[model samples]
Target: MATHTTFQFRRRMRPHRLALATLAACLGSGLTAPVCAQDAVQTVTISGRNSANAASVAGFGDIPVSRSPFSASVITTRQLADAGIGGLADITRLDAGITDAYNAPGYWGQLAVRGFTLENRSNYRRDGLPINAETVLPQANKQSLEVLKGTSGLQAGVSSPGGLVNLVVKRPTGTVRQLTLGWADDASLGAAIDLGDRSGAFGWRLNAAYDHLQPPTDASRGHSRLLALAVDAQVTPGLLVEAEIESSRQVQPSTPGFSVLGDRVPDAGASDPRTNLNQQPWRLPVVMAGRTGSLRLTQTLGKDLQLSLHAMRQRLDSDDRIAFPSGCSAEERFDRYCSDGTFDLYDFRSEGERRTTDALDVALSGRALALGLAHQFTAGLLFSRHEARFNRQAFNYVGTGRIGALVVTPADPSLTDENTDRDEKSTELRLQDLVVLTPEMSAWIGLRHSRLDRRSERTDGSRPIAYEQSFTTPWLALSHAVGPNGMAYASWGRGVETEVAPNRSRYANAGEALPALQSRQIEFGYKHRTALLDWTVAAFDIRRPTWSDLGPCDSGADGCVRAIDGSARHRGIEAEVEWRAGAWNLRGSAMALKARREGAADAAINGLRPTNVPASSLKVQAAYNVAYVPGLALLGFVTHEGRRMVLPDNSLDTPGWTRLDLALRYAQRLGSRQVVWRAGIDNVANARAWKEAPFQFGHAYLYPLQPRSLHVSAQMDL
Candidate 1:
C-alpha cells in the first residue's frame, strides 16, 4: 500500500495575524457584531440535536480555506435532517460545480466538480477518510456533508484541482432509540430505524434506511436501501474508542423515452405509461446498481490529542444495451450518417459493465501550541491508498426490434481479453498548522510536500516500483470578523490530479498512459448566521487544467498534440441558508457560475459553456412538526439547476428544470401503544423532470425523475 504522511509544521507567519473567537446567537434579529472577546466565546452545536446559540468563526472566515482555494459550504447533520433530504447526491446538488452523475439504467451517479473532471480522490470520504468511490458514496446514517469548491491545495495537497467533498458518518451516541417514517408528493416513500445504547464504558448503535417510489413524472421509478452500525466504548474516563461499519445498495431502472418539453412520452408502445416506464426499444435494455460496504475505527489518546483509522471496499456494476434511433435529427443535421441509408447502426451490446474500487486510509488530528509562538493551533497527519479496475465486453446486432428477429453480427469474443488492469499507489507526508497572530485577527498557514508514485502493470502481475512524482504546496489564509457571525477572507493555493483512470485510456487501447493535470486558483468569501438564518457567499477564478494528452497520435505529429492550448476561467458565487423558528425549519442553497475554455478539437470549447457546469442553480426546502397533533410532522423540498451545454457544438443543450417534493408523517401509538405507526406522500407536484447529460450517444438519451407515490411503515422506540 502506498501512503502519504506529513509531520512537521513550523513556519514564519504569512499574513493577517489574528486570533479566532467564537460566540452564540441566532440570525432572527439580523444583528451584527464587529468585534467579540474570547471570554465571551462559547461552544454550541449547529448540528441541531439541541438548540443552543454558539458562534463558530471557523465556519465564517476567508483566511484559511482548508483544501480548496475556492469557497466551501459545510452542512451539519442538523441542517440535513431539518431539510429532510434522502441521499448523497441530494446533498451534493445543494452546491454547484457538480453536474448530475446518473448514468446507465440505474441512478448510479458519478459526482463532478467544477466540470466533468475529478482528481484521484474522486471526492469520497467517511468521518474524514476515504470510503471508496471518489464520486458518490452511499448515504447510510450520515451526519454532515462539507463541499470544498475550488483548487484543492490544502486538505488534499495532492489531488484534482476539481475540488473535494467530505461526508461525516454517524457515530454511536451514549443512549437512545429513534425511529421515523416519511412520505412525499410525486410518490416518494421512506422509513428509518435508529438504536443506540451506552452502559458504563461500552456503547453501540445501528441505523437502517429504506426508500421506495414510482415517479409522478413519465418513466421514473427509483428505490434505495441503506444500513449503518457503530460501536463505541470509554476504555478509560479520559480515553475513548470507537468503530463503525456501513452498507447500502440503490437500484433505479430507466424508462429512457421522454417528451420534447422535457416531459415523459412514449417512444415505444402507448401500452407503457409515459409517467413510469423506460422507453428503450429493446426490452430489458439496461440496468445499473451501486453497492458499498465500509468499516472504520477511531481512538482518542488523551485530552489534547485524538487519532482516527478507517478502511472501506466499494463496487459499481452496470449492464447497458441501447437502440440507436433510426431517424435522429442530430445525425441528419450534422451529416454524420447517410440520410437515405437502407439500414443504420441500431443495436449495441455493452455487456458485463463492471467497475470496482477499494481503498485504505489512516489519519490523526491534534491540538498544540508552540513555546514562544503567540498563537493557539491545530496540527495533524493523514495517509491513504486506493486501487481501481474496470472491464466490459462489446457486441452488436444487424437488425432492430425483438432480439429473436435480429442476426448476431459475430466477432472474436476473446477481444474482451484485451481488457487492461492498472494499480496506482500514491503517498503524501504533510504538516500544517493554524496560528493566532493577534486578538483581532488570525492567520492559518500550512506547507505540504507530497509525492505520488504510480505504475500501470498490464493485467499480468510484474515487479512493482514507485514512479516518483513529487511536488510541494503552500496554504495560507487571513480573516477578521466584521460582525458577531460574519467574516471576510481571501486564500490562494495550487492542486494536482492523476491522469484519467488508466482503464479508460486503455479502453481506447492506446499503447500508452495519460499524464496527470494541474490547476491553480485564488478566491474570497463571507459568512453570517443569526436566529433563523445562516449563509456563506463567495466567488473564485480557477484556471483550466493543464496536462499532456497521453493517447496515441497520428502520423505528422512529433508527439500527441498538447490538448488545444487547453485552459479556461471559472468564476461564480455560492450561498447556503437555513431558517428555523418554533417547530418549522427551512433550508436551501444557490450557485451562479460561468466557465469556458479555449476552442480546439478534442479540447473543451472556450465560447461554449462546459458540459454539466450550469449557469445558475438553487434549492429550497421546509419541514414542520404538526402543530395540532402529537408525534406528527410535514416535510417538503425543492431543488433545481439551470440549462447547460451538452454537445461539443455548444448550441445543443439540456434545459433547466425545478422540482418540488412534499411529504407528511403521522406518529401514533398502536394496540398497547409500545410501537408507533407512520405514513405519508411523495412528489406532491408529481412534476415530470430529467437531468440533462448523456445525450451524446443517442442510445438511452434521458434519465427521468421519480413520480408521486404513497408509503406506510411502523417503528418502535425503547
Candidate 2:
C-alpha cells in the first residue's frame, strides 16, 4: 500500500485545484456584487425535537415532514452530540427502522432499513449529490442526517427498495468559534475546532479534527484525521453559489467475528469481549483515504420559479488486510467451527484498490396555477459515473487457531495478480408534481426513466462482461388534511436494481448479467403536530425478486446455476412520538416487521425468515432538567431488539436482548462565553449479547455487542 504514496498524493490534489478554479470562475463573473448586512445575533432554544421540521431528501423540495407522504426522519447535530454517536451502528439506537448489517469495528459502516440492506454505491448522498459510501465518512462537519424509509424511485433512479441516507453539510451560518475535547474509557482521545464567519456577501466555514482511538479489544488501535472547508457567495440578489471540499484518512485493523461450533451457538461468557481474532503479529492495519468536492449554483428565474445546478466528485483509495477466520477442520462440515474451538485462518490482503464517483444534476422547480388548480412541480436530469479498480487479492490458508490462544501465522509472500476494473454509467430524467385537488385534499405524482450501462474487465485472461438496461418507475400518493395540525396520506412506488452472477467455478453461468429487477412498495401513514407534541404512524409493504443458486446446471454438469427464482416480501409498521414540556423531554420509536421468502425453487427455504432481519424493535430516549440545579440535566436511553434468524434454512437463531444507557450534562456561562460538559456510560449493565449474525461467502459470522464503556466531552465557545 505504501508503494502508491506518490500516485495517491497526486490524485488527491486534483479535487482541491478544481474546487479553487471553480470558485475563481464564479467570483469573476460579470454579475454585480453588493455588500450584505452584518451577521445576526444568535439565540438558544430548548426543545424535545430531535430534528428540523422539514427535509428535502424526498426530492420534492423542502416539505414539512408531517405532510410528506413518505416515512422519513432526521437526526440533528445536537442530538448526535448528546448521544455520543460515532458511526452508523450507533444510529440504530435512535430509529427503530434501522439496524446493523455486518458493521464491524474499524470497518466502514453498513446498515439496513426496513429489513433490507442499503446498497453502498447508490443509497447514500451528500447534500443531495451521490458519493461513494465504501469508506469511513467523517461526522465532524455534518449539520444533520436524513433518512427516507422505503422505495425511492423518484429520488434515485436505481437503488435498493429499503431507503436512502442523505448527509447535510454544515454551511456558513454566522460568526462563531468553538473548540471541543473528548476522552473515553477505552483510551481514546480527540480534539476538534470549528470556525465560521461572514463578511459582505461572502461566508466561509472550516472544521478540523484528529483522534487516537483504542478500542477495548487487545492489540487493536488506530488514528484518524480530517479537514473540511465550505464557502458561499451571494453573487447577486437572486443568485447564490456554494462549494465544499473535504479530505480524510483513517488507518485501522478490522476485527473478525466469531462463529457457531457445530450446531450450537458460541457461549457469550466463554471469551472476553475484548478478544480479537485478527491480532496476529504479521497482520497489517487497513489504510483508507478519501477526497470529495461539490459545487452548487442557484438562480431565481422569477417570483415562482428557480433553477439550480449541482456537481460532485469523490475518490477513495484503500488497502484491506485481515486475518480472516472461517470453517473448521471437521470433515464434510465446513460451515461452522469444530467442537474443540479450532478454525481455519487465512491471511487476506488486497492493496491498490480505488473507487471514484462523479455526478451532475440540473433541476427546475416552480409553482403554477392551471385548470383551476394550484400545482407545485419539479423537473430534473441526473447523470452519474462510477468506477472501481482492484488488484487480485491474497487469501492463502494459514495455520488454525484456537479460541483462547495466540496464533503466530506467517504472512503470505505471493505476488499480486492482474488488475480488475468495473465501470458504470447512468442517466435519468425525472418529473414530479403536487396538485391541490380540493381545499383539504391533494394529489402527488412522479415518474422517472433511467438508462444504465455497466462493464467489467479482468486482465487475468477472464472474459469481459457488459450489460445495458433501461427502466421506467412511477410514484403516486394522495394526502388529506384532517385538521390544521394533522394529515393522512397513502403512497405507492416502484424501484429498480441490477444484479450480476458471481464469478465462481461452482456456477455454470458465472459472470452472466441479468436484466434489472423491479421492486414495489405501498405505504399508508398519518401525522399530527402540536406546540407540545408530535407523533407519526405508518404501515408499509414491499416486494422484490430474489436471486440464488439452484442446482443442476444447463451444461449437464454437477454444478449449480445462478438466476432469479424467488421473491421476498417485507411488511412492517412504524410509529414515532415526541413530547416536550417545562422540565421534561421524551422521544421514542417502535417498529414491527415480517420478512419472508416466497415462490422459491427449493421448498426448504420457502416461507423462511430472512437472515439478520428482526421481527420487532423499540427505542426510547428521555431527558429531564433539574429544577433546583438550573444548569444540570439527566438522560437515559432504552433499546430492545427481537430474535433474528441466522441461517437461510431457519435452522439457527439468536435470542432477543435489551440495553440501557445513562448520561448527564451541565451547561453554564463562563464570563462572556458558553461552556458545556457531557458524560455517558453505554451498556451499563455489562450484559453480553450477540448483536447480529450475517451469513456471507458460504460461512456464518456472529458479532458481539460492545462492552460497557464510559465517555466524556466538553465544549467551549471561544
Candidate 3:
C-alpha cells in the first residue's frame, strides 16, 4: 500500500488587499447604520491576565466566562508550576470533559474533549495563531492556557466540535531573574531559567530549560531542551510591535508499554516496567526538533477602532526510529500477550518527516451602533498554509524471535525511500457582533466563511490528488442576567473536521478526498459569580456524521468499499465550580456523557458507545494557606474516570480508575528576594492502570500508566 498525508487545505489567492477592502466596506456600513457618538468604540486590551474567571477566546474579545454563552477554562502559569504539570494532557485534566487520547509522554501530546478528538491539523493555537500540537510543546514560557468547549467555528474557521485550545505566550513584565531546580523519582534532573524586564519603550523576556531522565523501565534515557525569547516595542503612543521565537528538541529512548495484540488487554501485573523490547536500544530513540517565530502589530486607528496584524512561521523535523508493537503473531496466545511477548514488532525507522507552516491574520474590532442599541463588533481575515513530506518504508521485525533476542538485528539494513507530500491552505473571513438588547440581556451573532484546498502527491513520481471545499459556519447566542450574581445563556454553533482520502486498498475511488465532515451543537447553561466564588452548569448535544470501512470487495478490480452511513449523537452535562475564600482555594468539575454511534453499516454496531470515550469523569482540587505557619500552603487533588469501551463493537472495555495526589508549598522573603519550595507525590496509591486507544494508523493499542512518582523543586529570585 502507498503512504499518504491527509488533513490539509490549500488555496492560490493573495488576500491581504482583499482583507483591507473588506475592512473599509465594513467601516462604511457601520457608519451608516445607526449613529451613536455616545457609544463609540473603546480600546480594550485582551490578554490571559485580563480577568480571573474569563478568557479572550470569542469573536467579541474578553468577557467574563459567566456572561459569555460558552463553557471555558483558563489554567494560569502559577497553577501549572504549582501543580508540577508535565504536559498538555496534565494541564487539560482540570476540565472533566478532556481525557488522554494517546498517552505517549515525551513524544506527543494528544487529547480528546467532550467525546471528540482534537485534530492535529486545526484544533490548537499559540497566541491565537494555528500551530501543530502533535509534538512536544514546552510549558515553561506560557503565560496561560485557554480552552473553549463545543464548536469554536466563529473564532476558529475550521476545527473539531470538541473545541479549541489556545496557549498564551508570556510577555515581558517587570525586571526579574528566576531559577528553578527539580528532580523526579525516575532519576530525572532538570533546571530552568526565566529572565524578563521592561525598559523605556522596549521590553524583553527569555526562557531556557533542559532536562534528562533515565528510563524508568530500561537502561535507556530521554532528554529535552527548550529556549524561548520575546520582545516588544512601543513604537508610538498608538502603535505597538512584538516578536517571539521558540526552539525545542527532544530525544526519547523508551516507548510506553503497549499490548502486542490488537485485541487483548493485559492484566494489571502482566508486564514489568523494567523491560526493553527493542533489539538495539541505541537505534530506537526518536529525535525531534522544532522552531517557531511570530510577529504581531497593533495600531489604534481611532478611539473607536483597533486594528491588529499577526504572522507566524514554523518548521518541524523528526527522525522516528522506534520499535512499535503493531499486532500479535497469528498463533500468539492472549494470556501470554506481554508475558513473553512475541509479536510483529515494526522496526519503524521511516525516513522521518518535515513539516512547515505559515499563517497570517488581520482583524479590526470596536464599538458600533445598530438599531439605537449599543453594540460591539469584531471582524477578521485569516490565511494559513501548511506543507509536509514523509518518507515511508517497511522494515519488519517479525515475530520469529524472542522478545529480547538480538539475532534479528540485521547489519546494514536497507531502506526504501518512498516520499509522500501534502499541501494545505485556507482563507477565512469572520464577523461577529454583541448587541445590548436591554440593560439585563444581550445577543451575540457571528458568521464565518471559509475556503480550503488540499493537495497530496506521492513524490515517487505519482500524479497529485487534490480536494477543494468551502463552508459557512455561524454562531447564535443569548445571555440574560438572572440576578445580581447569576446569568443564564443559550447558544448554537457549527464545527468542521478534515477528512483523509481513501487509499487504493480501501475504496474504488482511490485517492479521492472526501468532503469535510460537519458537526452542529446546541447548549444551555447557567452561571453564578461572586467575589469569592464562581460556578457554571451546562448541557449540550452534538450531532456528527458516521463512517465505516468495508473489507475487500468480491470483484477485485474495483478494490474495496467504504460508506458514510448516518450520524453519531453525543450528549453531555457538565458542572464546574471554583472558590477562593479567604485563606482557601478550591475547584471541582464533573461531566456525564452519552456518546453513541447510530445507523452504522452493521446494524449491531448502532447504539454502542464510541471507543475510548468515558461516560463519566470528575476532578477536584483544594488548597489552604496556613496563617499560623506563614508562607506555607497544603494542596490535594483527585481525578476519576469511568470505564470506557475499548473497541467499536463494545466487546472489550477497561475498568474505571481513580488517582490521588498531594503537595506542599512554601514561599518566603529571604534577603529582600522571594524564595519558594515545593514537593508532591503523584499516583499516591501506586495504582496500575492502562489507557485504551481505538486507532493509531489502523489498530487499537493499550498504553500503560506510570507508577507512583515523586517530585520536588526549588525556585529563587536572583
Candidate 4:
C-alpha cells in the first residue's frame, strides 16, 4: 500500500470536463466508419465508482448527489468501519444537524434532525419499506445509511418535518468467508461471522454476531445478538427476485436518569455520572426482541421501462423496570438529599409493549417523449398498517414512619395494571416527472394524495375512539447548470405527520388521536462536482404544528393535565464537503439554526427556543495513510455543539461542549489470505457531558452520555 501512494499534490480535470472530452473524442472518430469495428469489438461497462465522492447515493437508486434537488448525505460502509460506529447515536454525529433525542439503554434508536424529533413510526425505512424503529436497530447487517433533509413529501407522504432516514441492507456480492473478534473498555466482547456464495443464477449471504458489554459507568450491563440472511435469483434474462430476513434481541440493566427540581433545571455539569441513584436489586433489566422479513420482484418491460413490487412485515417487543429521582430537594443540590440525604423516587415497574407493522409498495419507471421534450417519470403506490399494545404500572414513594419518612430505603412499589391498544393505517398515491426544458435546464413536479385511519381502545370497558383524515400535497423544483462543475436548484414541498395520543395520566381525552400535523418547507441550494471532491450548501425555512403539556387541568384529579396548542418555526443554513484524494480522505459539515415556538396559548412560553436544540453545530473528519508503513492509516475527528436550552421555558441553559476522537487502522496481505486490525478511542479528551433532555409530560428528562471509551478489533479472511 505504501508503494501505491506517491502523490503529494495533484490536479485533474473535473467530471463535467471529462464527460465533455469523451463525447468530443467519440464524435471525432466519425460515426459512418464504426459499423464494422463496433460489431467486432467487445466492451465492458463499469457499474459504479469506488471512490468516496463518486459512490452512488443509496436512497434514490441511480441518481447522483449533484443532480438531487434537495440536500442529502450518504454514509458508506468504509466510513462506518473507519469510525468504529456501533449504533445510531454514533452515526448521527457525522451530520451536524442530527442529534440524539430520546436515548435509553437497550431501548431504541431515537433521533432528531433539523431541530425536530424524527417520529419512530413514519420517518424510518429499510430498503424503501417502512419498519418499526421503536427498538434497537440492526446496524451490523446494513451496507449504508442515507438521510434526506427537510420535507420529503414526494416519497414519504406522512412523516416528520425534520427529515427521513433510509437503511440499505447488504446484498450478495461474491464468494467469501470472514470472521471477526472485538474487545472494548468496560469488559465488552464481540464476535461475528460473514459468508457469501453464488452459483449460476442464485446467490446467498449470511451474517451473525453476538456482543456482551459491561456498563460504561459501572452502573449497567448489556448483551445482544443479531442474525441476517439474504437470497436472490435471476428468474430469467429480464426478471429478478430477492428476499431477506433478520432477527435481534438485547438485554440491558440501566440506571435511572436525573431529573429537574421544582421548575429549576439541575446543574448537570456538576453531577458525576458514576453515581448510582437507583440501586434496587429486584428491578429487572430492559429486554428487547424483534423480527422482520421483506420480498421484492422486478420485471423489465422494454429497453426504457421497468416495474417493481415490494412487501415487508415486522414485529417488536420490549419489557422494562425503571426508577428515577424527580422533584429533588433544593437545599442539598449536590447530594439531592430529601431531608438530609434521602428523597422520594418515582418507581416504575412492569412496563411492556408489543408492535407490529406491514407495508407494501409498487412502482413504475420509464422515459418517453412528451410535448416535444424528453421526460423521465416515476409513479408509485404505498400502503402501511401499524398496531401497538402497551402496559404500565407506576407508583411514588411516601414514607410511613418517622425514622423511615425522611430517609427511605429502596423497595419495590405496588403497581396498578393499565393496558391500551392503538392501530393506524395509511395509503398514498404518488407521481413525479423530470422534464428537459433546454440542454442545461430542467423542471421537476410531483404530487401525492394521502389518507390515514386511526383507532384506540383501553381495557377499562370504555368506548373506543376512531379518527380519519385525508390530505393532498405537491412538490416543485427547478435546476440550471451554473458552470462546467456546478449546478443551482430551488424547491418547495409540504409534509404531514401523525401524533400519538396524550397519556391517560395527562389528559381527559387521553386515547383520542390529535389532528395530523401539517408542515411546509422552501429551500435553495448549489452543488459542485469534481474529480476528487463534492460539496453542497443550502438554506431553508420550515414550519410545523406542535403540542405542549400544561402543568395540570382545572378538574381536581391527580396526575391529570391539559394539552396546549403551539407551533414551531425553524430557519437554518448548512454546508457539507467531501474529498477522497490519494492517501488522504477528508469530510466536514456545519450548521446554524434559529428554532422557536410561536402562537402558543401561554404567552411566556411563546417565542421561546425549543429545548435540547443547539443554535449552531460543527463536525470535521480527516484520515491519512502512512507513507512508511504499508496499509497503515490514521484518523481523527472533532465535534462541537453550541449552548442548548435545558428547560421548556428557556430559563436555563447548558454551556457548549467539544469532543475529540482518534483511531488507527491496518490491513495486510499474507499469501492467499488477508488480515485487518482496528483500534480507536472515543472522547479522547475525557470530556464529561449530557446528551439532551427530551420533553415529555410537561417536563424535560435528562440523560447522561457515556464517558471516554476504547475499542479494538481484528478480522481474517479464509
Candidate 5:
C-alpha cells in the first residue's frame, strides 16, 4: 500500500468522538438522517479522526428514516468494519423492518417489506445515487449503506412501491492512509487497504479489499475482490474537479440440501459434507461472473452551489439451472400418479443468461435563493439506459443423466436449435428542490418525468414490437424541529410503474395480458435525537388500482387489463435506540408493520399479498471498547422475523419460522493500524427458518435457512 500524509491530514477519532461529530455534522448540514455505525474501526497514528437525525443524502442526517413515509436504515462504515461484515446480504439480514432479505433457501435472495413486492428497488446507493444497487453480488468498495423503504416513485424516478436501497462509496479524504486485516472461523481470510494523499490544491485516494471463505458445508463457497481509486482537486478554487472509480467481483456456489418433504432430516452423523447433493451439485449448471466499472466528475461553482456530472456502466451475466427428481418416491415417478408429486427431474436450465446495464445521471444543486427562505436548491437531469438479454436452453430433458434424454437436435454446444433473446431501454428526467423556510423548518419538493421503450429480439416470430411509456410525478414534504433535537415531518407523493419485460419470457403476452396503471401514496412520521440516542416512528398508505400487470399474471399474458386494480397498505411502527459512552456503544431497532392487498377475485390467486413479506421484525446490536485490552473490542447482534404467507398465486399463507445469530470480534494492532485480527459464528442456535414459499413444491415446502456455522477472517496492510 502506498500512502501519503500531509499537514492537512489528521488521525482517526475514537468511537464516541466519531458518533458525536457525525450527529453534529447532520444538524449543521441541513440533512436529518440517522445511521448505525459498523463495529470495526481502523486508525492511522497520523491518520484517524472523525465524526445524525432525519437525514437525506443531500446533507447531514437531518431527515428521519420515517420521512419516506415508509422506513429506512442507515448502516455506518464504522459498524461494518468492527463486526467484520463482507457482503450486503449479511448487512441487511441484521436490519429490522427487512424480512428474509437474504436468508432464503436459494442463493438469489431479495428484500421484502410490509408484505409488498419491493424487489426492483432492493439494491441500495450512496450520496443519494445508486452505487451497486443491481448487482446480485455484494460490493466491497462501500463506505456506508442506506436502505429506503416505500414506493419510491418520487426519489428514484421509476420504481415499484416495495422500496429501494443505497450504498454509499467510501471515498478518499484529504488525509493519510489506512488498512485493516482480520481472521474468523471457517477459515475465512480478509485484507483491506486505503490510501489518501494531497498535492497542493489536489487530493487523491485508493482502496482495495479481498476475501476467501469456506463455510461448514461443502456446497458453500465464497470469494470476493474489490478496488477503488478516486481523485479530488481544486482546479481554480471556484472550479473544483473530482473523479472516482470503483469495481467489485464475487463468486460463490452452494449445494441444494433439499429437505425430505420439507421437514426431512437425516441423522446428523449420516450426512456427508463432501457428498454432492444427489447429482444436482455436479449438474448445478449455475455459474455467475461479472464486473462493474463506474466513474464520476463533479464541479463546484460556489460555497452553497455545486454541480456534479456522473456516468456509470455495468455488465453482468449468469448461467443458472436447477433440477430435482420428477416424483417424490420412485413409485410415484414411474407411476406418474402419486400424492405429493416429485421435483423436476428434467432439470430445467438457462444457458447464456446474460444481462447488461448502462446508466448516465447528471445532477446540479446550489442555493437559488441563497440563505433566505431557501439556502440550497438542487435540480438535475437523469437518463438511464438498460439493455438485458436472456437465452434459455434445456438439457437432459427427461432424466437425471444426459444419455437417457432424447436429443431433439444434436447438442452443437455453440448456440443453436431452440433459444430466445430479449432487450429493453428506459430514460427519465427528474427535478428536486430543497427549500429551507427557516432555521427551524424545511420543505422538500421533487418532480420526475420518464419514458420506457422496449423490443424483443427473437429467433422466431415473438411479437417483435415496440411500446412507449410516459410518466410524470410530483412530491412535497414539510419538516419542523420540535425540540432542539426533535423533528416532525409529513409528505405526500404519487408513484408510477410500467410493465417490465426482462424477467418474464414474453411480453404483450396472451391469456392474462395486463396494461400499465398508476399508483399513489401518502405518509407521516416523527424523529428524535440527543448526543447519545436517536430514533423514529412513521405510518403510511399506498394504493395502485390500475387495470395493470407488470409480470406474468399467472396466465402468461401481457397487456391484460382484467380489473387488476391492486392496492396495498403499509401501516407500521419503526424505532431505533442508541447509547454511546466511553468504550461502550449499543444500538438496535424494533419494527412492526401490516400490509394488505385488495382487488383480487380469487383468494388463491398466488400473485397477491406482496409475496415473501413479514408482518413483524426486530433486531439489536451492541459494542464495547476494551480500552484496558488496548485495540480490543467486543460485539453482538441478533435479528428476528414474524410469520409470512405464500403469494405465488396470492392464495394461501405459509408456515412461519424464526431464526437467530450471534457474532463476536477481537481487534489487535499490525501496520500502523492497517492490519488486524477478528473471528465469530452465525446462526448460533443451528435452528431452521424458511424465508420464502414452496410455490409448486407444496403447501409448506420450507425454504430452510442456513444451519449454525463458524467462520473466521484476517487482514494485513502490506
Candidate 6:
C-alpha cells in the first residue's frame, strides 16, 4: 500500500488552478494527482508518479507537453538544485540548443537559441507578463523555468524569432518549511529558506537567500541578497486574486575575456584563465539592484467563459565600472592584440543608470461548439512601456598592458552627468483559436496586431529620434494524433523586430530608427510520452534581415551609411529524451545547426557562417539509485560542442571540446526530519579549452572554460 495526499476545493473551481495544483504536487513529492470533481466540492488525490508533464508557456492554457505544437522544455527547481545552477548561463549545460552570446562571468546573462541571439527587451517573461532581463535575475523564488523554441508571435507581439524564456513564480501550496546551506571552492557560502502556509481562503509563501561568493579568480569577490513574497486569496466563489513581489541586490567585479593576438588564436598557456584583467587598485565593483511586482485576477464569467487580468512592474538601477582592454597599436588590425601580447587599456565608468518596465494584459478564454466542431478560443489585449535613463559614460584610454603582467595607471577624474534618455510604448491585440476537426486531428490559428512608439534623445546637443510603426503577424499549425501517446505537428509563424542605427560617429544616420524587420519560421515536430519515457524531435528553419554598413563616404561628418543589406538563415534539427525506470534516470538533448548569411552586399561576408554558433552540440545527464544502499545515488553529466566559427568569413574557428562531471547524493530520515546532502565536482579532467569566441563591436573575445571546482550542499525539512 502507498500513502496518498488529498486536496479539496470549493464549488466551481477553475480547471487551470486545479491543473496547477496537480503539477505542484507532482513536482514537490514525485507523485501523481488525479482530480475528481463533485457537485459541491472537488478533490485531488496524489499517488506515486514519475514526472510532471504539463506547462503553461504555450499561452493557450495549461497543456500537456506532448500535445503542444511547438518545441519546449521545462526545468524544475529540483533539477536546478541537483545541478547547483546559480544563474541563467549555467542552464546551457542542460539543453543543446541554448548557447552563450557574450555571456561573461559576473555580468548579466546573454544567450542565443537556434543560432539567433535573443533580444533583451522582448524575449523574457514572468508569469506571462513582460519583464526586463537586463539585470541579474534571482532564481531562488522561482518554481520553474520554461523555454519555448521558435517564433512566439501570438504570445509576444514584438520578439525575436529564436525563442522566449518564462519564469514561473513559487506559489503557496500546503505547509512547507525548508532550509538549504551551500558551499563551493574558494570559500564561497550561501544560505536560503522557504516558508509557506495556508489559512482558510488565503495563503502565503516567503523566500529569502544570501550568498557570499569568492570565485576561483584573483582579486574578484561578490555578494548578493534576495527576498520575495507571494500571496493568493479566494475572494469569492468565482473570483481569485494573486500577487508577488521580489527585491534583490548584487555587487561583483566583472571578468573580461582575452583577445586574439593579431590574426592568430593565442595559446591557452599565454595567460592564466583565473586572472581578472580588470583588477585595478582604483576599480569599483559593478552593483545591480532591482525590484519587481505583479498582480493577477481571474474571474469565472460563466460555465464556459473565463476572464483574466495581469499587470507587472520592474525597475533596475546599475552602477558599472571596469578596467577594459581593447585594440592594438597596429592601424591595420586595431581590434586585435599586438603580436607581443600588449593591448590598449581603458577606464570605463557608467553610473546612475536606471531602467523601468511596466506591462498589462487582459484576456478572455472559452470553449464552444460551432459548425459541429469544438473550438477553444482566446482573445487578449496587451500594453507595455519601457524607459531608460543613462549618465554620460567615460571611456578613456589609459596605457598599454601586457599579458601576465600588472600595470596600473592613474584613474581618470572625470565624473558622470545626465546625458541619454529613451522611451518605448507598445500595444497589441491577439486572437487565437484551436478547432477540433476530428477525434484525432486539430488545427490552431492565431493573429496579432502590434503598434510601437519609440523616442530617444541625448543632452549633448544631438538630433533626437522618434518613430512609430505597426504590423500584423500570423501563426498557423496542424497537429494529428498518431496513437494514444504520440502526436505530430507542423507550424508556421511570423514575427517583427525593431532596429536602430549604431550610435557611432562613423555612421551617417547614427541613432536613427530604421524600419521594422520581419522574421519567419517553419517547423515540423513529433512528441511521444509513456509511463516511463518521453521524447521529442523537431526540425526548424528561420530567416531574418541583417543590417550592416553598405557604402563608405568621404572624409567628412557623414562617414558611412548603414542599412539592411542581407538575411540570416538558420536551419537546425534538435531532439530531446527523458527516461525513468526502476532506479535509473536519464535525460539527453542534441542539436545540429547550419547558419549562414544569404544575399549580402559585401562579397567577403556572403554565404559565410555566423560568429560563435556551433555546428553541433550534445548534452546528457544520468543518475542511478544504489539498489543495496537504499539512501545513496550516483550522478554523471557529459557535454560536447562542435567547432564554432570566430570570424564572419569562417577563416578562424575554435576546435570542438568535451567536458565530464560527476557527483554523489545521499538522503536519509533522522528523528522525524528529512535531510539530504549533495556533492559535485565539475570539469573533473581539468581540460583547458575556449568555451566561446564572439566578435562584437569590431573586437574579438575569447571566453575560457572554468577549471576544476567542487560544490557541496545540505538541505533539511523543518
lDDT ranking from best to worst?
2, 6, 3, 4, 5, 1
Worst 10 residues of 1 by lDDT: 6-15
Clash pairs detected, candidate 2: none
What does candidate 5's lDDT look like per residue over 185-235, in tens digits? Answer: 445566666777776888877877766655454444566666777776777
Show pairs that collide, candidate 4: none
Q: What global local distance difference test value does model 3 have?
A: 0.71
Please give the distance, in angstroms, between residue 277's alpha carbon in candidate 5 and its true position after superposition.
4.5
Listed in order, each prediction's TM-score against the native is 0.72, 0.92, 0.89, 0.86, 0.78, 0.92
lDDT of 6: 0.78
- lDDT for position 523 in model 6: 98
C-alpha lDDT values of all predictions: 0.50, 0.79, 0.71, 0.68, 0.53, 0.78
lDDT score of residue 231 within candidate 1: 80
Better structure of 1 and 6 per lDDT: 6
Candidate 3 lDDT over residue span 1-718, tens digit each: 1111111010000001112333233222222122121100111011112124456666556455556788887777666665667567786446797887765654676778898888876898888888877577777788788887898888777787888888889888867576655567667776777788888999999988777766355645778889999999999998999999999998876454455343466665565544556545435677888999999999988767889999999898887676655555555543223445556555666556888889999999887666676677888999999898887654665344344444354422356545678899999999998777776677889999999898888767585788888999999999877766677899999977766646655477667766667889999999876656778899999988866665565567565656566788999999988776666778889999999888777789789898778899998887777777777778787888888777666777788888888877776655645456677877788777764454565556566556667777555544
Off by over 4 Å in 6: 1-52, 269-271, 330-332, 413-419, 502-512, 553-559
- State the local distance difference test value for candidate 1: 0.50
**Tens digits of lDDT, candidate 1, 208-265:** 8776644444334566677778887777665566666666655454333332221222
**CA deviation > 4 Å runs, candidate 3:** 1-53, 254-256, 260-264, 273-279, 332-340, 400-413, 417-419, 550-559
Prediction-by-prediction clash tally: 56, 0, 5, 0, 76, 0
Per-residue lDDT for 101 in model 1? 48
